[model samples]
Target: MPYPLNHWLATVGFGLAFCILASGNRLRAEEVDFVRDIRPLLAQKCFTCHGPDEGTRESGLRLDLADGLFGELESGAQGIVPSDPQQSELYQRLVADEDLRMPPLDSGQRLTSDQIGLIRRWIEQGASYRSHWSFEPLDPTPPAEVEAEDWVENQVDRFVLAKLAREGIAVSPAAPPQTLVRRLYFDLIGLPPTAEQVDAFVADRDPNAYEQWVDRLLASPAFGEHWARRWLDLARYADSDGDLGDKLRPNAFGYRDWVIQAINADMPFDQFTIEQIAGDLLPQATLAQKTATGFHRNGLKNTEAGSDQELDRVVRTVDRISTVGSVWLGLTVGCAECHSHKFDPLSHRQFFQMYAFFDNVEDVDLKTGHGKVTVATIAETKQRRETFVHLRGDFRQPGEKVRPAAPEFLHAFEPRSGKPDRLDFAYWLVDGDNPLTARTTVNRYWMHLFGRGLVDTVDNLGVSGEAPTHPRLLDWLAQELMRQGWSRKRLIKLIVMSATYRQSSQPRADLVDRDPQNRLLARQARFRLDAEGVRDVALRTSGLLDHRIGGPSVRPALSADITAYSRNRDWVVSEGGDRYRRGMYILYRRATPYPMLQIFDAPDTTASCARRDRSNSPLQALTLLNDPVFVECAQHAACYSDWQTDVDWIPQAFRRFLSRDPSAAELARLRVFYDHQRQTLAEFTEAQVRALCGESFAVASADQHDLREQAARYLIYRCLLNLDETITRE
Candidate 1:
C-alpha cells in the first residue's frame, strides 16, 4: 500500500493552513517599478503584435522601445502621451469597444480591469521606461540601512529585512539550533547529520559554532560531490550518446571528475569557465585542461545506419551555442536561430556570430595515463569551418556568413587576433563589463541555497524574464563575487552565514494574505530535496553509501524491464561496494534512466536544466515503500543497531532519519503504531516476515518473539523514511 497522505501531510505541517497560505493573494509594490511591473505586461500582451519582430509587428509600431511607443503610429496618432491617459492612444485602445480593442476582437486577449488601471497609473506617473533590470551593470551602491538593525547579520540580511520592513511583514525568527544544523548539513554536504554531530552542535557554547561548521563542510570533499551535480545538469552531462541507438560515451566521467576536482579546489570562476570553453587551445595545456573541454561535447550525437552526418554536426553546433547562451549569458539566444528574437535583443545575425566561435571546434578522444584511459574533449579544427546563418534554422538553407563575436547589445568583444576563436569568446564571457555572467552565476548559487533565486526565472534574465525581487541585493552579491576573486566557496559561506538564510521556514499567518510566494524573503523557504539528494540522504543514513571521491560511472542494479530499453542490454550491476556509491556516479543513460532517481524528477540531460521540478506523487510514496533500494535502506537502518536493547528506539530512529527528536505526541503515536505492527507481525508466516524485513532482520530464528519485534522495528523505520519530513529540507 502507498504511504498515507494524511500521515505524511501531518508530519510535514503542510495542511489546510499551508494550502490557504499558498493561495494567490500577492500584493503589488507601493511604487511601480517599470521593469518589474510594466515590462512583463508589455512583453507578454502588447509585444506579440507590436514588439521586436518587424515582419509581424502591426502598424509599424514597436511597444518594446521608447522611441516607438512615444512616436506617432501609422495612423498619425501618438501611441503614448506621458502624464495624460486621456490623450494616450495606448490607454484609449485598451478601454476601447470590443471591435476596436488594442488586441482586436479576434486576438482572444484582453487586459483585465486591474491591468488597465496599472497602465493608466503608469502613464499618469510620466510613463517611465527603464533599461531591463538584468542588462544594467551591477550597482556599486551599498544596501540601504534597515530599521531592524538587531536582526541584520550581513548585507544579505539588510536587504531582506529592508524589503520585509517595507511590506510591513516581520522576519521570522532565527530557526532553532536543531533545524539550523540539519539544514546546513543538507544544504552544504547534501547529507543528513548523525545524532552525535547534532548533539555536539546543539551543546556547543561558542558563538562561532555555526560559522565553524560552514567552514568545515565547505572544506569537505563532499562539497564538490554535492555541488557538481547542479553544474552537470546545466552541462547536460550524460553517459550515453542520446538518440535511438543510445550508444555509450565511455570517457564522459573524466569530465565529471574534472568538475568535482575543480570545485573541490575552489577554482576561480573565471578560470573555471575559461578552461571548459577552450582549454585545449591554451598554450601547453595539461591533460586535465583538455578534459575540461568536454563541456562542449556533452550534447546529443547521432551515429545511426542512415543519418545526415553534416546536419548532425550542425545540430551539435546549435546545441553548443544555445548551451553557452543559456548557461553563461542567461539569454534565450536559441530563439533567434531562425529569426530575430521577438522578446530580447538577440538578432538572427548575432546568433550566428556567437555560433561562429564554436563552429571551428571538433570532438577528439584524448589519450591519458599512457593511453590507458580516454577523455572526451574538443580541439580547434586544422581547417576552420565558416559559419552561416541557417535560414529558418535549416542547414540546407544557409544564408549570410558571419564572423565570430559577442552580441552587440552586450560589451564589445575585442579578439587578440583578426580572427577570434573560442578562447577569445571565453575571455569575453568573463570580462568585467559583461553584465549577465556574474549576476547569472550568483543567482544560480542563490537558487541552490534558497528554494528560489532572487530572479525567480533562473535561465532567462532577458527582458521577458522575471525582474529581481531585490535588484540592489542581486547587484551587491554579484559585485562581491567578482571582488572576492570569483570564489564560489567564499560566496556560499557568506550566504549560509547570513541571518536571511538562517530564518525559520514556518508559514506566517499574518503574511498569508500579503506575500503568498514569499518573494519578500520574510522567511527562508522549505522545499523537498533534489532527486539525487533524496537518494544520497537515504544511502548516508542507511550506512550503505560509499563516500569515495570521483571515478568512472557505475551501473547500479536495475530491473530487467528498465535494462531492456538500452540498445546494448549489457548492464552488469557493480560488485558489492560499488553498488552503494552516491547517485552522482550512477550511469545516466538518457533513454533508460534509473527508476528511483527519475521518479523524483531527475533531468533527462537532453538540454540545459536551470532548475528541476519538485513533484509530489503517489508513485514516489510507493517507491519508498516498495523499491528494492529503499526497502533495503529501511531494513539496514532499522537493524544496524539492536533496537530491542534500546527502550527509546522511536526517538533514536527519528534522529537517525530526520536529525531531530520527536515531540511528546509524535513519540506517543509512533509507539502505538509500533505496538500494533508487532501484533500484526506475530501472526505472519516466516516467509512473509522475511519478505518484509529482508535478510538483515534474521527472521529464521526459532524464537518468534525476536522475529515479531524485528519486523515491527523494520516497519517503523520504513514509516519514518516515508514521512514527508524525511525527504523535505526545511
Candidate 2:
C-alpha cells in the first residue's frame, strides 16, 4: 500500500496554531519597498502590454521605466501621479470599468482589491521606482535580525528565520542525527550511508561532526557524479541524435565525463560557463576545453531524408540561444523570437543580437550512421558572419542585420570597440555587473539542495516568473557566489552547513494550512529520490554497485522490444561490472531511454530540462518487484549476510536498506512475512524453484533445498527494497 498522506497532514496540522501565535508581529503597510512589493505587481499586471517591447507598447505608455511611468502618456495623462491616487492614470485604470481595465477584460489577469490597495498606497506615498530586483547589482548586505537569534547558525539561517518570523511561522527543530546524516549523504553524494557510517556519525559527540561529514562528502569523487546529473539536464546531454532512427552519439560520453571531472575538480563556476559556451574559441584551448564545447553539440540533430537542412541549422542555433538564456540568465529569451518579449525587457532585436553570437559556428555534417558520434569535439572557425533577424522566426524572412550583444535589459556590459564574439559574450555573463547569471546559478544550486528555490520559477526569473518568496535572501546568495569567486563547492558548502538546511522534514500541524509549499522554510522538504539516486541506493545496499566513476555510457540490459526502436543501430548490453554502473552512466537514447529511468521521471534529453517531475505509480512498485535487475539486487542483498535468526536478520535488513534499525512493531510484521515466504518456498515444486532461481540455478538437484531457501530470502529482500522509505530521501 502507498504511504498514508494523512500521517504528514496530521503532523502539519498540529503545528499550525503555534506558528500563528509565534509570528503575530507583521510588517506595517507604510514600510512597503518598491522592488519587493510594487515592481513585482506592476511587472505582472502592466509590463506585458506597456513596458518593454516598443512594437507592443499600448498607447505609448511604459510602466517598467520610471521616466515612462512618471511622464505623461500619449493620452496626455501621467500613469502615476505622486501622492494622489485620484490623478494617477495607472491607479484609475486598475479600478476602471471591466472593459477598460489596465490588463483588459480578456487578458486573464486582474488585480485583487488588496493588490490594488497596495498599489494605491504606494502612489499615495510618493510613487517611486527602482530597478527590477533581479537586474540590480547584487548587494552583500548582512542578514536582518530575527527573534529566533539562538536558532541562527549562519547568514542563511538568519535570512530564513527572519522571513519565518515575519510570517509568524516558527522554524522546525533540527532533525535527529540519524535522519540528518542520511539526508546529508544523499544531498551531497547521491548515495545512502552504510549502517556503520550512519551509526558512527550519530554516536559522534563532536559539534562539527555534520560539517566534517559534509566536507568529506563534498571532496568525494561521487559528488561530481551526483551534481553532473543536474548539469546534464540543463545541457540536454544525450547518447543519441533524437529523431525517428534514434541514432547514437557514442562520443557524447566524453562530454558527460568532462562535466563530472569539471565539477569534481571544483572548477570556478564562471570558467565552467565560459568553457561550455565558447571553449573552442579560447586562445590555445586545451583538449578539455574543446570537449567542453560539446555542450553545443549535445543538442539534437536531424538527418532524416529530405529534411530542410538550412531550417534545421537555424533551429539548432535558436536552441543554443534558448538553452543559454534559461540555464544562465533565467529568462525565456526565446519568447521574443517572433516579435518582442511581451513580458520581459528583451526586445526582438536583442534576441537576435544574442543569437548572433552563436550564428557563426561552422556547420558540420558528420552523420556516418546510427550509434556513432559524428563530431564528438567542436571546432569554431575564426571567420565571422553577420546575422539577421528572422522576421517571424523564419530563416527565409530576414528583417534587420544584428551584431552580437547581451540582452539590453541588464544595462550592464556592452561590447568594447569591435563586434563581440562568443568568448566576449560568455565573459560578459560573469563580469560581476550582469545581475541574472549569479542569481540564476545560485537559485538552481539552492533548488538542488532544497526542494524549492528562493525563486520558484528557476528557469524564468523575468516578469512572468513567480516573484521570489525571499528576495533579500536570494540576493544574499547571489552576491556570495561572486564574492567566493564563483566557486560552486564553496557556495554549496555554505548552504548545506546552514541551520535552516538542517531542519527536520517533519512539518508542524499548522504549516500545512499556512505554508503548504514550505516556501517560508519552516521545515526541510522530504521528497522521493531521483531516478538515478533510487537505483544507486538499491545497488549500494545490496552490495551490487560498481564504484568505477566515468567512461563510455553503459548499455544496461533492455528487452529487445525497446531496442527495436532504433532501426539502424543495435544495443549490446554491457558485460559484467559495466552492467552495474551508476544510472548517470546508463546509455540515454533520446527516443527510447532506459525503461526503468523513463518510468521514474528521467528527462528525455530532447531539450534543456531545468527540473524533472517526480511521479509515483503502481508500475514503479511492480517494476521493483519484477524487474530482473532489481530482483537480482534483492537476491544478492538476501545472501549478503549470514544471520543466525529472524530477529537479527530483520533488524540488519532495516539497517542496510534504511540506515535505521526496525522498531519492535515493524520487526513483528516482517517476522510474519519471512515465515510465510519460507512456508511457501518449502512447498514449491522443482520447476517452480528453477524458475525462481532463473539462470543462477545451474547446480544439480542436490542443491535444490539450498536454492529454495535462497529464493525465500529473495522474497523478503524484495519486500524490503520496495518499502516507500527505502526509495525515499527524508
Candidate 3:
C-alpha cells in the first residue's frame, strides 16, 4: 500500500528520525524537535483557518505565531502552556469529541492518534518554536565530518555522506566510465556523444580526464544553446500572442538570442537578473540590455477587437508580479492579491506595493499589416502612475494607494540615493543579506543537474512548500553562490565536480525500501531527458543537426491535421538547413505548439514554469515511431558507411546511438530482427519497393535492389531510436 501524504512528507521533512518512526522504531524523549516534528503537522492540518490570513482566522486566535498560541486566548484559556499538556487547549482540542475537534469534520482533515500523541509529548516537554527554515539566514559553517574519509571528494559529498551515516545507509559506488561520459555529455551540452569521442574518453587513463572533459564541454557553444531552453520556460517565451488571434511576434527571438549569449559569456547572475528586470531604465543602456527588458514583454496580449483593454493590461501586470515572485524568491506572492497570504506572511497591501514598480512600463499594442510582425518592447514615460489594491482582485474597484516596495517580510530595502524603482528592486533581490534569491537560484541549478532539488518544490519556498531534507547543505550552497561573485558557471562547475554528482544512478538493493525518492542522497537518480534534449539527441546521433547559433525561430514541417486545429494559422515551413536547427529554435505558438514537443511535455508558456513534467505515455511512443522528423533521422542514420559485414553494423549502431557497445545477448536479439527485415524487403516487387520509399527516394535513386537494402537498414535505425535508454539521461 502507498504511504499517506503526511507520513511521506514527514519522512522527507525530518530526514532520519521520521524514517525510524515510520519503520515502527521507538523514539527517545530527547528526539522530538518542534521545528521538524510539530510545525509541519500544524501547518498542514490547522493553519488554513487559524494562521496568516486575518480575514479567515478563527476565534481571535492564531496557532502559527508563538505569542498567540502560548499566551491567554479570548476564551480565558491558553492554547499551548509550556510543560503542561493537560492544561493546554491546543492538546485538548485535538483529542476532543468529534464535533468540537480541531480541523472540524467538514474541513476534510483529521489528526491520527499517533499525531495527537506526538503533540501531547511535544507540549509536555516544552513548546519551543524555531523560525521557519527557509526564512533563517544562511548558515556559513563548514560541512560536518563523515565516517567515510576516502569518499570525500568535496564539501557536497561530506554533507550527503553525513546524512546517509545517520540513516545507516551506504552510498552507491561510482558508475562505469561509459555511463559517466554519457551522463556528462547530456548534462553539460544536451546532446549525445559521438562514438569516437566516447571511445577516446573510455580509453584515457589519466585521473583528471573527467574534469578536463567537463571543462571542454562547458566551453563548447552548444552549452549555451542547451541551458538557454531552461531559462526560456521562466521567461514565458512564445512566438505568438496567446488569446483569440494568436498573432505572431517576430522580435521575441532577440530576447532568446540574448539569453544564449549571456550564458555563454558566463555573465554574473546578479547582473543578468538586473538587466532582464530594469535594463531599459538604466542610463545609456546598451542595445543588448534594452533587448533584455523584453523579458516582461513576453507575456500574452489579446489583439482581438472588442476586448477589455484596461482589464487585459491589469492581468499583464499580475503576470509580471507573480513571475518575479516565483522566479526570484520562490514564493506564491500572487496568492495575496485578493487577500492576505493564507500560508506565508504577506499582506494584500504588500502585493500592490510591488505592483507599483511595473505599472509605469509603457507597453501598448501597435497596428500592423497582415502577416507582418512587430517587436514588443519596454519603454517608460516621465510620469509614473500610482498603484492601488484591487478590491477582491477587481480592476473596477480600487482600494488604498501604495508606492513601490519589496515585500516587508524579507530584508528591508533602503534606498541609497533616489526614489526606489524596478532597478532598486533588482539590486535588492541579489543583495547578500536577503535570503531567498541566491538559495532559489542555486536550487534551480541543482534541479537541472540532479533530477530533483533539495527542496522538491523549486517554485515555492514559503510555509506551504516542503522543508529541505538537508537544510544546512542548502544554506552552504547559497552562501557559496554569493561568495563566488554570483558567477553561474563557477557554481555549476563546482556541483558537477563533486563526488555526490558522480554516484551511480542504479539504486542499492538495501536502501531502496527505506528511501525510494532518494531524498537522503543515498544514490543518483535516473530520469528521462527534457523535451528539447530528447529531440536534440536523435538529431545529433543521426548527424542531422545544423549546429548553427540563434537567429530566427524555425517552422519545421507539421502534419496537416495539427495545422488545421488553429483558426488563424499561417505556418510556412522553413526551407534548407533551417528545418534542422535545434529544438529550442522551433517556433512556439501558445495556442498550438509543435505536436512532438507537446507530446513530450514541453511547457505551455502560459505562466512561469520552473520545472517541466516528465511523462511516459503511448502518444509519446507513437510520435517517435511515426513522426516525420524521427523517420528522416532514421533514414539519415542508415546511410552512414562504416561497417564491413551486414551483422557488424549492430554493435556500431548501438555505440553511435547509445554511447556503448551492445552486449552479447542484445547483439543476438538484434541480429534476428535485422535478418527478418532484410528478407521482408527482398520479397517486395519493384513497384512495391518504390511505394515504400517515398518521392524523396525516387529522386535520389531508381535502383530497386539498393533501395531495398537501405530500407531494411532504416528499420534497424528506427528500432534503435525507440529504445528507452536512448532518450533517458542516465
Candidate 4:
C-alpha cells in the first residue's frame, strides 16, 4: 500500500483543526453517556444497516460507529463530512425526500424535530463518540447520599425518599393492619387471610408472629400456585389450537403445576430461568425439567383456517423473544424487530443476533405432528427454536441473514459460548453481570408484595421506563436476590420481613395530607383482593370451596346462553356435575369461564396478562348477591351449623362466614328477615323454597334448611362476599 503524502496532509489538518477548537473551549461539551443519550438514538434509528451485520450494506451507508460514518465507503462517499452539514451524506439521508427515507420503506417513526436538532448540533459541534452507560463497568459503591437522614428507612429508602424530596413529595404513612395482612397474604400466597386469620394476627402479642406467617406462607403449597401463575402468564400457558374446535394439550397443566412446585420449593431464580429455557438440555434433566420446558410451549396458537403453520409458528417464536426480554430483562427489545429501537440502547442488528439464538428449531403439533407444523420448545425435541431476521417482522421477505449475538449495547458482558443458541441464549440472559434479569425478577416479586413495583411499570425499564421510585431499593433487592443464591423465596421473605412490609395502611392525618400515592411507603400499599383471591374467599367462607388439588383448569357453572356462546346461546347453569366439585384446576373448558371470575376481573385467555386491574363495579355486586354459586354456598354454609340444634343458627352462621363474634344489632336484623322470608316461602310448596337457592327440591337437603336458624348465616354469607375485609388486604 502506498502512503500518499496528500492523505497524510489531510489527516494532519483535520487533527489540528479539532485541537484548535478544543483549545478555545476546553471544557468537554455535556458528557455524552451513550447508554443515557447517544446509544438510544443510534440504537433506535440506525443500527439495522450500519450496525452489527457484516453480511450486507444498502447504498454503501453504515452509521453504526464514528469510523463507519466518517470514513470513505467503496463508492468513495462518506456518511458525514464533520462541520459541513450541507456536505454530509448522513444528514441528507435523515431529512431525505420521503421516497428515499434513510430508514427505508415502511419503517416509519422518523427522527423527532428535537432529535433531528440534536444530531445536527452534535455533528456541527465535532461529533465525539462514547460508550453506552450500561456497558460501562458498574460502580461498587452507591452514589453520593441524597436527602433527609431521618426520612431514610434503609439505604434503599434513602435513595427513594431523596428522589421524592427533590420532587417535593413525601412518602405515605404506614397502612392499616387489616390492609397490611390482606396485602401480605396475597403477596405471599395469591390468596387472602380468613377474617379469623386476620383477627388472630392482630391480637398476637408476639412480634415474630408476622415473620413466622410470611415464612409459613412461603413454604405452603398454595404459595407455589400463586407465584406459578405469574410465571405461567409470562410463559403464555394455553392448552389448545387448530380447526377442530380447541385441540387440547391434555397435560399442559403439568407444566403449570410444575412451575407452582418450583416456586414453592424456593428454587434459586437463576436455576429457575435456566430450567425453563434449557431444562431439557441439562445432562440429567428429570421428567419435571422436561415438563418445565412446556413454559416455552405455552404460548397461544392461531389454528384458524388458511393459516400458514410454519410462518405462524415462526412469529410465535419471535414473540417468545419479546416475552423473554420483557419478562426477564425488563427491557423492550421487541421494538428492534424491523429497524432499530427508537428510544433504547439496542440496534436492529443486535436484535437479529439475539434472534439468531432461537432460529433453527421448528414448531409441530404435539398431538398430530402433522398438518401445519408449529415452532416452539421444538428446541427441546431437537434444538431450541432457531432465530433469523424476519424482514420487517414478515416471514416470506428474506433480508440479510444474521447469527445469534447479544445486543451491542451490552459490550461489558457477552454470552459464554462463542456460538449463540437457546442454551447459550439462556446463559447470557442470567449471567451475573447482565443487569436486567436479576432486576426484572426482583421487580416482579416486589410488585407482588407492595402492590406497585419500585419501578412501577414492572415490564418496561428501558430508556422509556419510569425512573424507579426507589433506585437504591431495587438495586438492593437485586443484590440480595443474587446474594441469596438467586433464591426467589428468600428474596420474597426478605422483602416481606422488612419493616416497610409490616407497616399499617391507615394513613396518619398529617401524613395523608403530605403524601398521596404513598411512593415513600410511610406504610404498606392497601390492596384489594384480585379475582382469584376474591372467589377463593367466597368459596372458602361459604363451605362451598372444592379444595381438590392440581389437574386442569376450572369452569364454574354458567347459564346456557353464556355456554352456547352464540346468537341463540342457551342459559344452563349446572349444579350436579363435577365441574362444580373439582378444584380451581379442574374447572376447565374454554367456552365458559366461571361467570363469577369474569365479573371480578380474570383476563381473557386469548393473551398474556401480568396484572389484573382491581375495579369496583355494579356487576361485581350483582354476581355476588344473585349468582347460583353464592346462593348454593350460602345454603350449605347455613346447614353446616346448629341451625335447629345446639346453637343459634344465625349467630353461628355469622361466626363461620364473617369470622367475627357478631353484634346484637346484626342478629336482630337477621331475625326480622328470617320471619318474613320463611312466611313468604312457607306459602309455597317445599319444591318452591328449594328451587330458590338454585338447588333441586329434596335432591340435596330435605329440611327448609332451617330458614329461621339459617337466616343470619345467609346474611353473613352475603355480607362476607361483599366485605371490604374479604376483598381487601387491609
Candidate 5:
C-alpha cells in the first residue's frame, strides 16, 4: 500500500527506514580445527538437504539462522561437546557418513579437502561472527593522517597525502601555467581555451593568475552552458517524449536555457534543487523557475498508439523518485521496490512510501481542444494512484497498505510537512540532517570538475559507495556548500582555484606507477571533448558560428538521405539561412537521433541519467569524417577562402579554425591545394564557375556549376575542419 499522491512529500521523509528484521547474518561463521572444525563443516555440507527452507529443515534441525544452529537436533548430543573436538557428535556424523553420512548426499559440488583443512584451522581460532565493515560509520578520527606543510590544501589532501606519506610517497608540485589554464577552462566551462587565452595565462607573471582565471570562467555565461548540461544529463534531459512516439519537444530548449541561466546566476544549490523538484510550487517562481519543473517531465514517455500510458507514467514517477534518491542521496532506494534492499538498509515498504510522494503530482495534458499541441501525452487516461502493496512486485495483487515514509538505513529523518507539497519534500532533502543530499551534490561537482568523484561512484555514496578519499575534504566541501548558502558558483570557483584541480594531465613515471588512475588528483585527468563541444568548437573556430543567444531552437541542416531515412523529413541548407550555423540549433530528436550525437554517447533521454557514459568507439571516427554536418561546416569554412582576391587565404583560414596563425608547413599544404585547384578549375567556363559558386559567373569554358575553383577550396577546407584534434577539447 502507498500513500495518496495528493498528499505532501513530508510523509515519506519521516520514518522511511522502518526497523525490519535484518535478513542477513550479522557475522561470518568462525573456523574450526579438522575434527572440531569438522563439526560445523559437516553441518554446512549436511544442511542443504537439511537446511532452513521448506522441504528441508532436515535432521530435525535447520542451518539458516544462528538460533537454528544452536537449537536441538536429531543427532542431539548437544551437537558437539563444547570445546571438545573428539566428542563432537556432528564431526563423527560427517567422517562416518559414507553409510549413515550426515551430508546425506554427495556430488560434483562437494567441498574439497582444503576446505576441510580450513574448517580444522577455523576451530583453532574460535568462531565468531561480525557484520560487514560498511554497516557502521567510521571513528571520529581515521587511524591515518597526512601532514604536509604546503602540499595539503583541505582535509581531503591531508587524508590522501597522509596515506601516501605513510608509505613514503609524495604528491607533485603545482602544474605549469598552460596545464593549469586548460584544466580550469575545461573543468568549469567544459571547453578548451583559445590559444590566445592559454598564452595570456602562461605569459602572465602574476601569482594570482590562476585565481583570476577561476573567477573569469565561473562568471562567464559559458559556465552555465557547461555545468547545467551536467545537471541536465543527470535530470535525464531529452528533446522528445521517449518510446515509439517520442516526438521532439521543441520548447524543451526553454528548460535547457533556464538551467543555464540558473547556473550563471549562481543560484544557491539548494534553491536550484528545490526549483527543479518543485519549482512549480515556489511562491515567487518566475516562468524560468516554473520551467525548471520540467525536470520530472524530462524522463521518458510513451505516446505510441494503443500504449498503456498510465503504466508508463507511473513507471516514470518511480524512475523520477529513484533518480532523485540515487542522484541526490546516493542510495539505491529503487532496489527496495520489490523486496527489502538485499544489501543496503532500505526496505520494500520504503520504496512505496517514497513512491507515494510523487503519486499525486500529475503529468497533465497541456493542450486544450483536441489536437492543439505538438505532441500527445503518453497515457491516454489519467488515474490517481491507489495505495496498495505490489505483491512480489506484481501490481495485480496488492498485499499491504502503506503511507509514504523514508528508508530504514538513515533511520530517523522527520519530515515536518506532508505530500504533494513536493516543495516541502524538496526542502527536507536540503535540510542539514539529510547527509546524502549535500555529499552527493558536492561529489557530483567534484566529478564534473575533475572527471571523477573522490568517491568514484558519484551516484552511490551510501554504505555501498567507496570510502571517501578525503572524507574531511568531502565533509568540508559539503559544509562550505551549506555555509555559503548553497551557492554552486562559489563552490565551483573554489575548486577551480585549487592547486589540486590545476595539475597537468601529463604523467610522472613514478606517479604513474603508484597512481596510474590519478584518482588522488596528482594531476588533472585528460578527457576528449563531448559531443556538443565537438560541434560547437568546429562552428566557433570556423567564424561561421552564430553567437546570437536564446530563442526558439534552430533546426540544423541534415543530409537529405539521413533525413529521408527517418520520418521522411527534409532540411534545406542555405548560406545565410536563419539557423544554418549555430551548433545549438541542431535538433535533439528522441527516436531518430542524429548520428553524430548518437555515436558520441548522447543519452537517449528515455530515463533519468545521473551520468552520460563516455565511450571510445570506432563509429565516432566515421561520423567525424563522413557525417553531413561536419561536411557542411567544413564547406562553410572553405567559403572564407577567396582565391580570386590573390590574398593568402590559408593563413586566414588557420586563424578562423585554430585561433592562431598557421605553421609554415600548414601554409605550404594549403598553397599547394590552392594552386592545384585553380589550375584544374581553369577548364570550367566563367558561367559554370558562377553556377558552382551559387552565383552567375560570366564565363566561356566552364562546367554547368562553373565555380570549380571556389568549390574545390571549400571541399578541401571541409576536410581540415573535420580533423580529430580540431573537434576534441584537449
Candidate 6:
C-alpha cells in the first residue's frame, strides 16, 4: 500500500539528506582525486578569499591551480611542497590555532577534522591538481566490466552495476509489467494509460512488447506537448509581460507551437540551438525559423510609466546571457555581472563579452500563417551598437570596450569572420571541443527521467557543483549524444531501454536508513508528477480531456478573489471544449496566477527554472478536494459507473483512476466507506441529494434509493481521485 500523501512526500521529496553510498568504496580503496574530491571542498571554503578574483586575494596565495599551491609566496614561504604535509604552509595554517587559522576569525568558516585530513593526505600524496571535471574533455574509455552481466541491458547498465558491485549492493529486479506501462506513459507523454492499454501490454507474450510501446509513444503527438513544457520552463515562457501592467502577449502561443512542431519533427539539438539563438540571422531564413527566436523574447518586460527603458533592455540582455550560460554551459555566469566571480573562473569582462552577443538584437513581430497572428522575435539591426563593460553593473557607468566572445577558460572562441555576431557565438557553444553543452544537455534529460542529476546541481556545473556519482557514465552519455547526431528522441529512448531505468522503485529495507537520497541508482526513482502533469492525469482519467494539439491559451474559470490579481479584475472562462483543455494550454498571467497551479508550485515564469520544488501541504489537499476542475472530473468519473445496475462499480472505479485492480483489503475498506457515505446521504431530502450531485447529473426524477447510491459513488470517486498514488509517478 502507498503511504499517506505527507508521508510519501517526506520520503521521496528529493530534499532529504544526501549520501553517496556508491562513491564511499572509491574513497576507501583509491587515492583521493583532486578534481572530484578536493577541489569542491576548497572551492566552497577557501576560493572566496584565496582563489580567483584578484581583487580579493590576500598574501598572494591561490588554491585553484597547481602553480599557486606550490609556488613561493611574497613572504618567501611555500604554500604546498611535494610529498610533504608537515612543512606545507597550507596544511599548517589549516591546523593552526583558533586565532591564527587560515580563514581568519571573521570569515565565518571552519574546517572539520575529516576535511583537514583529506587536505593533508592530498599534500602528502604529491598534491596533484587536474582541471575541473566539467572543464575536461569527455573520457573515451569503454565502460568498466561488471560481474552481474545478467542485469545489463545497455552500456548504461554496465556502468551502474559496476558501481553497485564495488559497493556490495544488489541491483533491484525489474518492476512489474503493469507498473512499467504506467511509468512509461507518464514519463513520455505526461498522461495516464487507458485500462485497456495496460491490459494489452500485460498480456502480450512477445519479447519486444516494451520496446514497441516505447517507439509508439515517442511518435505520439502528445510527446511534443510533454517535452515542450520542460523546455518552456527553461525559456521562462509566459503569456504576459510581467510587472504591474501585466499586459498580455497575444501572439506568444505561436512560439509555443513552433517548439512543439520542432520537437515533433525530431530536429537535431545542434540545429535547434542555432535556430533559437540566431535564427533570423540565417541567410534567407523562413518564417518558421524566425519564429524560433522567441526564446529571448520570453524574458520579463517592464513598460510601467517612468521606468527606465535603457535599464530594462540591459536587464533583458543580462537574463538572456545568464540563461544561455545556465542552459547550455551549466555555469552561474550571472554571479560575475557586478564583480568578479568568487567561485568560478568567470571575470567581469567575460560577463560583458557574453552580454555583447545579445546586445545588438531588437524585438520584432513576424506575421504568421494564422490570420493576423504575429510572434514576437528578435532581429539584428542595420546599425551596430558599441559594447562596453558596465562599471559595477550600472549601464550609466561604462568601463572598457569589449566584443562578443566565449569565456577563455573553457574553449577558444572561433568566429566565422572578424566581425562576429550571435551566429558565431551559437556555433561556439555547440562545437565539439566545448566540454559543457553535451554534458549539460545529457544531465538535463537524465534528471527528467531520474529524480536527481548525475551532478545533483542541474543548473551549475562549475567548480562549486556537486561531483557526479558515476563520472564515467556521464561522459559516456555525453559522447553518445554527439555520436547519435544530437537526436533527443533516440537518446531518451536509449535511456528508458536501459535496465537501470527499469528497476523497481520499491525502497530496500537496508538502504532506507543509509541511502535516503537514492544516489546509488540501485533502483528507479519515484516522484510526484509536475504541476501541469498532475492536472493532465486527472482530466485524462475523467474522460473529459479535449485532445486537440495547440492553439491560443485558454482562460479557465477563477473565483473573484483569485481573479482580482489580474489587471482587468476578471477572467473570461473559455467556451465549450476549450474549457477542458490540457493544463499546458492554460493562460499564465504573471500577476494573476491560476490558484490550483500556483498551489501546486508551478513556476511563476519570472526566471528560468532548473528544478521545481515538490512540497506537500494542507492547501494542496484542500485544493484537490474543492477545486472546480477536479470536482467536475470526479462527477464525470463517478457517472461512468452504473450505480443501479453494476455490482462491481467499486472495482471498476479503482481500475479507471489507478489503472490497476485493487487489493482485497483495499476493496473491503472502500466498501465500508461507501456504505457510510450512503447512510449519510439517506438522511438528506431529494432536493438536497440533487444539489450535492451537481447540475450536470440527471436527478430530475430520482428514486430515493438510487439517488443516495449515486451520491455515495460520487463521494467515493472523489476520495480515489485525491489519492497519493493517483498523482505520483511510480
- Candidate 2 lDDT by residue in tens digits, 194-213: 99999899898898887888
* Residue 414 miss distance in model 6 (angstroms): 0.5
- Name the 10 consecutive residues with the lowest summed lDDT in model 5: 1-10
> Using Cα atoms with residue i matched to residue i, what is each candidate's TM-score against the true structure?
0.93, 0.91, 0.92, 0.74, 0.73, 0.94
lDDT of 5 by residue, 1-730 (tens): 1111111012311111111221222212253323223434444465445442333344456443334444455655655344454555554555565686555555333566686556435434543332222222322353245456465554445555665665466566676665566556666776567667866877887987667778888888777777777777787776777677776676666677777788889888888888877776777655556667777777877778898866786677778788888777877767666765544545566777777767667653343233543221222124656667565666667877876665534435466564334666777778766667777888888887777786777776644455566556776787778888999888877676555665566656776455666655666665656677776666665555666545455566666777786552634443454454344445666777766767778777665566567775656655665565565566555555344555466666655554456667657666666676677667876655545444422222344433564566664555455444354433
lDDT of each: 0.84, 0.80, 0.81, 0.61, 0.60, 0.84
CA deviation > 4 Å runs, candidate 2: 1-49, 93-122, 125-128, 146-149, 363-375, 564-569, 643-646, 693-702
39 in model 4: Cα distance from truth in Å? 10
The RMSD (Cα, Å) of candidate 1 is: 3.2
Q: Order the numbered candidates by TM-score, best leading.
A: 6, 1, 3, 2, 4, 5
* Predicted structure 4: lDDT: 0.61
Better of 3 and 4 by lDDT: 3
Model 3: what TM-score? 0.92
TM-score of 6: 0.94
Model 3 local distance difference test score: 0.81
Cα error, candidate 1, residue 255 (Å): 1.0
- Error (Å) of candidate 1 at residue 469 is 0.9
